[model samples]
Target: MSFALSTTVDLDFDRTVAALREALSTQGFGILTEVDLSGTLKTKLDVDVPRQLLLGACNPAYAYRALQAEERVGLLLPCSLTVRAGADGRTLVDAMDPALMVELTGTSALTEVAAEVRSALRAALDALETR
Candidate 1:
């Protein structure tokens, strides 16, 4: 609960996704994977969900630091961000809070790395607000 950094934007889903990609890039993150959650669910389970996309974002330097701190941390490798359509017709963006790594691993060594990643993610979300 309360595990993400989120914002709602005025743009529609597709536009929001595009803007988010650029925003994340500005924060030194690259998309390592993308998933169209809505589409996949509709196809796989015949269930309909609101338009949703998941982006696996990664910043190499931060990731490396995390890896050095915890050998198994790569299991959580590549941060996740989601773009989804809200009922009000606005698009919502959410990024997984990096602090979760420290919580889950119970390691102080990852604290700094998590903070750096969190800041970058916050900056990226702020960038979306300006667009």
Candidate 2:
């Protein structure tokens, strides 16, 4: 299965990032971390690239449940979401598929938690459609 739920929006990069954050929040997620991929690459490797951001999104309730199911699940604690500029000047968003956690951990116990997370992530992505 594909590992990500992705969508493209017509907004500019910064606006798309803001919209993504808002959409996630509406679905009970919060941005735990943000990594500017473009800036990082430029600063660390001296290479220029299109604007890109990585957002670590977490829904605490789901996180707690996942942790309870598997102690090592922290390895996948926060779901990753990305907002990047496309070559055509549009914005692209991609969110990790939570179901992957179940496959990676080899545990059926995480099925419910993963389903919930997947639903929330899907909702967040759907919200972007209105933008």
Best by TM-score: 2
**TM-scores for every candidate against the unseen true structure:** 0.97, 0.98
* C-alpha local distance difference test of each model: 0.94, 0.92
Per-residue lDDT of candidate 2, residues 47-72 (tens digit): 99999999999999999999999989
Tell me how far the alpha carbon of residue 108 in candidate 2 is from the true structure, in angstroms, after superposition.
0.4
Indicate which candidate wins on lDDT: 1
RMSD of each: 0.9, 0.7
